[model samples]
Target: MTFEIAFVLLSLLGMVIALILDKMRPGMVLFSVVVLFLCAGILTPKEMLEGFSNKGMITVAMLFLVSEGVRQSGALGQVIKKLLPEGKTTVFKAQFRMLPSIAFISAFLNNTPVVVIFAPIIKRWAQSVHLPATKFLIPLSYVTILGGICTLIGTSTNLVVHGMILEAGYEGFTMFELGKVGIFIAIAGIIYLFLFSKKLLPDARPDTAVPDEEVEDGEKLHRVEAVLGARFPGINKTLADFNFQRHYGAEVKEIKTRNGQRFVTNLNQIVLREGDTLVVMADDTFIPTWGESSVFMMLANGKDTEPVPGKKKRWFALILLILMIVGATVGELPVTKEMFPNIKLDMFFFVCVTTIIMAWTKIFPARKYTKYISWDILITIACAFAISKAMVNSGVADGVAHYIIGLSHNYGPHVLLAILFVITNLFTELITNNAAAALAFPLALALSQQLGVDPTPFFVVICMAASASFSTPIGYQTNLIVQGIGNYKFMDFVRIGLPLNIITFLISVFLIPLIWPF
Candidate 1:
């Protein structure tokens, strides 16, 4: 390899290590690598900053606001409650009723918000029906992931790939184009979960550190579940230093970490991290006080602490979401494209309109709009573009692609596709999915060019492999949220998600070529 290629490769290795070791936030780690590329003359300043103005990254930012509007309307929380049957039910029955709807909902809204809203409700419902919360939490996370693959806006990674494709002088994906393969994958994966998840998942019960008894002031202590977001002030600090009770007027009863450890004693010694679920004991005002705060991605009452939102607001928010989806889908039609040649009525356009309408209508708190957007994720995606560009600029992707082609040429493109899928999937399971896609995109592009085929199939595989993050909590943010709230061990995911990962791998390898011809 040339020195520039060697340097890019080594920098990527260090970036992945930093991400996996939790040396810093993922956005910072990725941004650092992009900066390194700029300093090494692999990228110009404009090239490095191109990602910040990417269409996909901007769409992702808007979707976060739309999701926040829906979340604040309290419609989803109510819908989840209705989805769960009240009477006695089997795990199969409960999953059948719950998982599919959630999958569909997540296809339009961001899956992170879907999980943030649904997890606590499902956990509470599971307890009510005398079922294991652990049995359902992982399934909830997995199904959302499956659903996200079905649409362009379903997951940020899809949009990220689309943005990269556009940047590469190809047509971007339509709203439902991914659904062709994504639907089958979702069906097969959901069926697998329905059949085996119950047997594979653990039966851990919820552990309440403090009882719901009355205190000296004749006030009842309420249990509140808070899933820490990237903005949590206490992240990386111990309770002794942060003083959780003094700051929030709530006592940290316990902390459930993504590593699958639950700390009920000596909690002051443990360092906090994003995606950690805190079981807190507070007064009646806790949920109302911190419900809309950005520090916690989600805050659900352990009991019914607040009244459900009005039917009107729920319907309005739902309608707005539907309009955003349909408008984007129809605008991409050839007829519409011809009608509005100068104005592309794509996801970006519709999302911008929807967010502004919601803001004016007071769907979500408009003033605190910054709280809704996860800037870290946005930064990560923007830097991902720059990183991918550096790979292409330095010829690292060509070098690696030729090496892989040499190994698999004897076996033909099928083996090559499988190998690429495996490599991308391994990176996703170890680090962030967006980073994984950025890392693999250039190689996929080079592979298609060397083989003299359309890069569409290779691109599809990257999307599938990148988003199909299973077998580890750290791979996806949703998994981390579930791991903490479900109080599961790392082995719990390995036991259950590993098979699903293989299923996704098999489906992507066998089906993508059929859908998007190589």
Candidate 2:
């Protein structure tokens, strides 16, 4: 074993342990590993920090602002209201009418905002139509995830993989290149939900429905949901033992586990886990005080998450988004290249222009633009690039790839591709999709090189696998968002999502290679 290989192995082991121990953010863990490599003379200062300035990373940052603009503009809400058929009265009919449209819209928009805007609307509408909201909510999240895989910018994971591709000196994905296989997955997923979902999905999660009573002034009681993080020192203790109300000045109504199990009536019996989410009723000050606290991994209340844009501004924001998509798509054409030989036109150019215009127009409170960006995610992605490089530099990626090839030699690249898909999907389920893609990309590239085949199929599989997270609410952000709002149980996700996961696996393994010709 060479010194570089040994050092890389130790660094990877330490990272896994640190992440599993839940002590540090992924960015911090990866950055610390890079520091070790730098100190040991394994990598130079420039190479170690190059990811911070990476074009793909910066593009992701810019897209955050762009998505924020659309979210705040209220265009998504208007579109959903218009698109949902007025006469749909049953869960099955409503799903048939809505899921495909949601999937199509989600292919063009960010999944979180789409879920945030649509989840409440769907729940209210389901109640009005005498349907089970639990039926449509999980499908809402699942379809958005499926739709997001169709476009390069649909999920941050896609862009992260694209960034890795560019960093590895490969051609990056085009605007709709992923649609080739992604559309099939989305269509199949929608069919599955339409046919089999009503039987499997839960009818209700206890205490998920909002309380009906309002104040004399017609204002709703402020109900906030928060998850305990490192800041709260009361892990593994009951609420009675911990004195919940005295410390936080809030009344805990229910506790939702990470897997979506809810303890609605018993607040004192169940012990608290660090990531356990408590649905509490408190005054308006709860969000203001604990919003930025490290004690809460998440703090969410309704309606105040983003400001609603007026009708005119909403239309303007929608137009800006459409132009960005169109410009980016058209810019990739040969005719456009011929027309503008000296200048470049791509998704990056359009996204940059859109973000700047939205900021200037104050589409989403330009003064606090940085607040909208998830700094933790950006940091994680930047560091992930460096970590992938370290693996390649130390030969760790190639070594692992060869071992897998040695074991699966008889079945050839098809088996290796399937293994990659399964591994990447499991990682996405356990960690963030962007992190999963980053960790899997280096090995995928190494495996392709070993087999002397096109890496396109491998890259496509990674893109699909990382975004195909199901079977758990924690797997995807959209799933988590809907889980709380819909009052879902853990088994609800497992029953419906497990089938979808299997479907995604089969389609990706069989369909991706056909399109990319590995």
Candidate 3:
């Protein structure tokens, strides 16, 4: 095998293993692989570095800041609080009441913040109304994801694919262009959840859900999970001996071992191992104190409950978000170029202006702006661009495309689109969605080029497949967020999300060809 081909295969294998094992973050793993390609001379420095300055990747970053500003504004939370049904309700009634509005918000705004703002509120609402919180949590995440697929700025993955299309010298998606198919998928998805979710999803959440532990006086406990690392000093020590509570200001709720059995009954006598996972009850102070500590490498579900923003600030933030969305959507029309050629009235222009305004206005904690942006994701995306370039440079994309084509040679582009959807969806389930999109883009593009068709359809399928990450918690961040709070088992995702995944796959394969064509 050629050195380039060997390197690419090895890099891909390593990524698959890394993402599956989850020993390292997907962004770090992808970046590390790109660095290897750079060292082997498989790719030039410029090619490897293209992702750093990628318009899509940077746009994602700016959106993060914008989302943080919105989150801090507390406007989304208040809106959701108002929209939730009053008094007790049936599962279908609750879903019918909220999913459409949730989807609308998700279609225009970032899904992560929407979930973050809404999940707890929904959970509390469910509890007060004598409903199962679990029924709503997963649905909340899924609806946001469904909504995100509708607009360009709705999800980072959409923006990443949009960025790639522009770089390939094609006309990128306008703000509402994706909504053409996306709206249909969103409608299909919400309808699917509404009709079948009660039967499909689990109605699980502890009837006596533990309250947050007091860090100081009068602070309630919040249940959280922390995975142990080698850096933890009390590896073999019992919690009682280690004084875990005294040291961390948290109480152990349960101890799940590497062997998979949880010891919620007698955790004090159990010896902590490097890989043992601890379910603890902590207060807000725990995050700032031990969140970065090496002792627990993966800490989750310690959400802070801040008071909502004042009416004036909330209105200002809401107005800013509306302006950002309106400006971007309106600018995509023919009138923009003829009337405002001098102005760069694209999503990029509006996002930049909105980000700056939010920053100057201190909508979020200005000093902690860096904390909101997932630098690892940005790094992974930047590195993914290089990885895609490497695949193209090494002829890996064409080779893979040809091999698949040989098997499906008798089949038309629809079959190819199905296979592409399945492949991208698999990659997404194994790795990050952005990483999956980056890897799939080149192959999808090559497949279209070889078939003598427009690459637009392939691009649409890639977007559809990459974001249809419903099979596993690892497939999407939103899944993990809900998994932690909902007390979901691995099978919970498989049972519920698998069908959603299949539904999306079907929708993409059937609609992309009809809409964009081969």
Candidate 4:
């Protein structure tokens, strides 16, 4: 093989290693690889940094703000309270009523916030009805993922791919174009979850426990605990060397030394001895994975948990979210576009206003709610665009596209569409959803160019397939959110999600060509 090919292959291998290890955040891993490529003269500095400026990156950042605003408004709380039937109800009926609405709402908003809003509500409702939450939570996340495919702004992954396609010199997707196939895939997914999820999903629910004594207000320190295990990448590292705060959303609060020195405050230079304790303050979603790696012991009580918003804040947050959606939809129209040319009514504008309004209102307390946004996710998506640009500029995407076209030499567009769907879906399972789309978008454009056909069908397929992350919780944020809240084992997701994944894949592969023929 040529040296360039060998270099690309090696760089890609390193990326895979970083993904599996997950010691550093995914965005940092991608950035590190990009820098390495630039130093090796494989990619230009501009190419390495281009993703930060991509429209997709900006849109994603704005969407986070918008989601935050809605979450702060308390809109979702009201929806949950109304949908969650009181008194005794069968698991099937309760799920049918709630899951579809959640899915539909997710099709318009971010799925992570949707899951966050619903997880506890579902849990409480399940308790009230005497049913295991396990029966509904996995399906809840799965449906949101499926529904995210229906609109451009629904997920950052879709917008990132859209920007990459635009950069590739093809026409980008319209707001509703993906809906043609997305709707069908969502329906198929919902049907699969409704009919089969109950039988296949596990019944792992956390046992109720007595409440612990409250910490003294003055004596309490801002702290979090994380258990480390064999799977952790930083097993032998020290606190001084480990850049936890820079990478993950954490700050080291205190450490218990191996010599049983409890609450060691001056641990900056201390080595992380095995079986040592680490007190940290960060988002709880990330704590569980630390235990899988044997990095430390477990979190202190209340380490990986967030309190549900009170009644007043919940109502305010929910109303603001609805208004933002209505405003964005109205603002995007041709009439509004013409009237508000200078105002520029796009995802960024909508999210900014919504965030500002929510923050000003103190609906969920500006300081606390600000921390809820996943900044790492935004950075990962931004870096994904740059990696995609590198892939296209390096001619790697074209080479892969050529191989695909060559394989289906005599086949029709239907076969070509199926190939694209499978490729995008498989890539998403392995990497970040946005990264997968970024990598796939260029190939989709190249294939359409080679075939002398319209690119919309190919683009549509990539968007839907990228968001159809049903096989693994690790693949999508929503999956992870529900996994912890539901107390689900890994295999439970596989049992229910594997079938939904297949159903969405089949529907996309067959229906996309028919709806938007090449």
Best by lDDT: 1
- Candidate 3 lDDT by residue in tens digits, 347-427: 999999999999999897777787778777888888888888888888899999999999999988899999998998999
Range of the 10 consecutive residues with the lowest summed lDDT in candidate 3? 298-307
Candidate that would win on TM-score? 1
Across residues 363-473, which tens digit of lDDT does each residue of candidate 4 receive?
Answer: 545665545555667677767766666666667777777888889899967788888888888878766787678667778887888889988888888888888788876
How would you order the candidates by lDDT, starting with the best? 1, 2, 3, 4
Worst 10 residues of 4 by lDDT: 291-300
Q: Is candidate 1 or candidate 2 better by lDDT?
A: 1
Sort every candidate by TM-score, greatest first.
1, 2, 3, 4
Q: Put down candidate 1 lDDT per residue, 257-356, tens digits, no spaces.
A: 8787888999999999888889898888888888777888777775653336788988999999999999999999999999999998999999999999
RMSD in Å for all candidates: 1.6, 3.5, 4.1, 7.3
Q: Over the full model, what C-alpha lDDT does candidate 2 score relative to the true structure?
A: 0.83
The local distance difference test score of each candidate is 0.90, 0.83, 0.81, 0.70
Better of 2 and 4 by lDDT: 2
Report model 1's TM-score to 2 decimal places: 0.97
Model 1 local distance difference test score: 0.90
Clashes of each: 0, 0, 4, 22
Give candidate 3's root-mean-square deviation (CA, Å). Answer: 4.1
Q: Which stretches of candidate 3 lie over 4 Å from their true place?
A: 207-248, 255-279, 283-304
Please identify model 2 stretches exceeding 4 Å from their true place: 85-88, 208-249, 264-277, 283-307
